[model samples]
Target: MSRLTAAEQKALAERVLDIESRAVSALAGRLDDSFAKACQLCLDLTGRVVVTGMGKSGHIARKIAATLASTGTPAFYMHPAEASHGDLGMITGQDLMLAVSNSGETQEVITILPLVKRMGAKLISMTGKPKSTLAKAADVHFDVSVEEEACPLNLAPTASTTATLAMGDALAVALLESRGFTAEDFALSHPSGSLGKRLLLRVADVMHSGEAIPMVTADVSLSAGLVEMSQKGLGMTAVVDQQQHILGIFTDGDLRRTLDSGVDVHKVPMAEVMHRNCKTIPVDILAAEAIHVMEEHKINGLLVINEDGVLVGALNIHDLFRAGIV
Candidate 1:
């Protein structure tokens, strides 16, 4: 069914990528005062940005709306064809409409312009034809015109859609900086994602606390510390003073070393075998930071301390894995 050889197919694929890349690159040099004004309009809006388009442009519009919403701007996509069927009610007077159409003359998109104006909403249009109805009617216009389509026949939307998506990204990043959007803010919008877990999960949230903590008094026998570690399943036991302040930690590695020296586990005290001045983390630090501490010290676990230097909890690499932080 195919007439082209393998080499011809590869050439076609490369040409598509080349044309699309150039289309997006050209948009970088065309940025003007209108781009800034567009960002400002979105930043200053009291309500959301309502993006709408038809056909292939609609797909790009939906992505742009999602990007805006996730990057500290309130925005959503509205189907242009469905707008006339009562979906226009989603728009309020405080909202701004971002309409996308390569030709700027899409009938469904243009039909809602009069209604949007009567409702007192501002308009921003992304289009190839600056003089087309949709572009001329907007309060601000972004020209996404390209040299030509990447389609071999120069008819498909290949290049224009890529240019429009790049322009939308430019608007989003500019607005993100102007709004002072931080990673923590992004975590709030993506609470179910891995970044949210890294940013929002705290040491206290994952560390074993109360009776579950593997702890032993410094005067306890090394054998007794081993029993505590086995019971708590944390691979190590914290050695604490009577006031609950951490003294040191005794791990399985310490056990092997003590055994090699022919020391009796039943006779040696935890204070004699424990590692002194071991790493400890604050309870309020991020769980991600806990991982960093473990890696920095080349240890498998850490003791958690409160503001008063009291050992309150403990956690190991296994805990990080269970919490999806690893």
Candidate 2:
């Protein structure tokens, strides 16, 4: 055996990519009424989309099922062999069956078709051979045929699998659009992920309120405000009035400025040193949005207020980081 030279290897890799790219592009022309029908079947399903296949096709089927489930379609992949072994009980008449087999005659998948049909499930097939038994048996057939595999002997399932995956993506995205699925909906399905945290976690959910908030009356001495800030460990304190209305904010930076100006910290009032027009965010906004506001203003902390302009909560850059919003 001999290894190809670097230049030869690069050329071979490019050729393979080009072949797979063309195969996926060709599927655009194959989209027809059958594709629409398949999408409609999935859209109308009240039960889960049951995806099944064998061998390499089964791998692609699992990925397709995941994509569908994440993008607002309820779906799961069932191994054909397992389905034949009483797992077929998972499928219901309200479900839609999506079967994948490049040759359209994998014995395991073919053997379970009748049982799926007898359950009155709508059948959709993805195959490289349109005339094969699996394609003919399905109520809707998606042609995933490729000109040839990227393999030298054209035996490997390369281009065909790429085409099949692309078609599956198309179906999932079409259904996603028809259902008016939003990024918030996707975030809900992925609640444990960083994107979900950014989209779903609100300001009030992670903010320090009541006794946890570092606040002082506007009439308090600057020295007292600094003590409140230090005790709260948030590096800042909100200066509020008797009615709990935010008058201003005093942070570590304001303390530094007061020291430089040679003001009497013990005698001067907090209202004299606090930033009267400091940034404030609504309690109902997303924590991600609060981070944006902090970044835009070059501030380290924010005062959360309600619609009536009463101080409700307080948060800082560290809080956002702790909440996985930063």
Candidate 3:
């Protein structure tokens, strides 16, 4: 045999993706009332979706379980051989079983069907053969049949596994929609994920509160604002009114410009040198959104305000970095 040329490699890769795409496309056509029923079973389930299979199907099963769990359906995968040993106890009467086997003759998978039935858990089978033993034993059957494997020899599992994974995603997404799974709901499930942190982390949670906030009165001398800025290490201080309502903001840069104008720091009020009409954000806004605002405005910090437009908090670029929003 000779080494494959670059052109030939490109052709083969396309062939594989084409075959898998066809397989997944056919799955969408095969979806009918049975697919809906599988979703209904899983949607109504109080317990998790117990996914089980062997070899290639097992990997697909694990992926299916993860997608299901992430999208709002509670789910997990259990190895068939392990299930027969002792892991079977993980399934409960309220749970649903999603068994994936292309040939429908995986002995380990079939061996657990009766036990799953004994637990009063609903079994949904995804297989190439509708008349196969596993399909006949299931409460619902989804035809995950593929015309051919992408493998040239037609021996390795390729297109069939892709179809099963696609079908599992379809099922999970259907359940997600039916259950009205919102972004907030998904965030709660994935508190440590990037999307979760963006939606759930509020300015109040990450902003400098109480003594950590840099503050000064409008009547304070420009030199005094610098002292507050240096002591707080926030690079700036809030210039507030007599009642502490934010009138403007003063920073180290403001002090520099005022000094260049030949003004006395001790003589000038902070209000005279502070930036009027400064942009501010609500204290309830997400920290992720704060990053976007700061980037858009080309600024490194923000003044947090309440409903009455009073400054309640202060945050800088370093705060977003600490919260992993930067």
Better of 2 and 3 by lDDT: 2
Give the runs in model 1 whose Cα sits over 4 Å from its true position.
321-326
**Best lDDT goes to which candidate?**
1
Q: Which of the predicted structures, 2 or 3, would earn the higher TM-score when compared with the native?
A: 2
Q: lDDT tens digits, residues 182-212, model 3?
A: 9999999999887788889999999987888
lDDT tens digits, residue span 70-173, model 1: 99999999999999999999999999999999999999999999999999999999999999999999999999999999998999999999999999999999
> Each model's TM-score?
0.92, 0.92, 0.88
TM-score of decoy 2:
0.92
Model 3 spans > 4 angstroms off: 241-247, 276-282, 288-300, 305-311, 321-326
lDDT of each: 0.94, 0.93, 0.89
Predictions ranked by lDDT, top down? 1, 2, 3
Higher-ranked by lDDT: 1 or 3: 1
The number of residue pairs in model 2 that clash at the backbone is 0
- Deviation from native of the Cα of residue 254 in model 2, angstroms: 1.1
lDDT of 2 at 60: 99
- Give the lDDT of residue 307 in candidate 3: 92
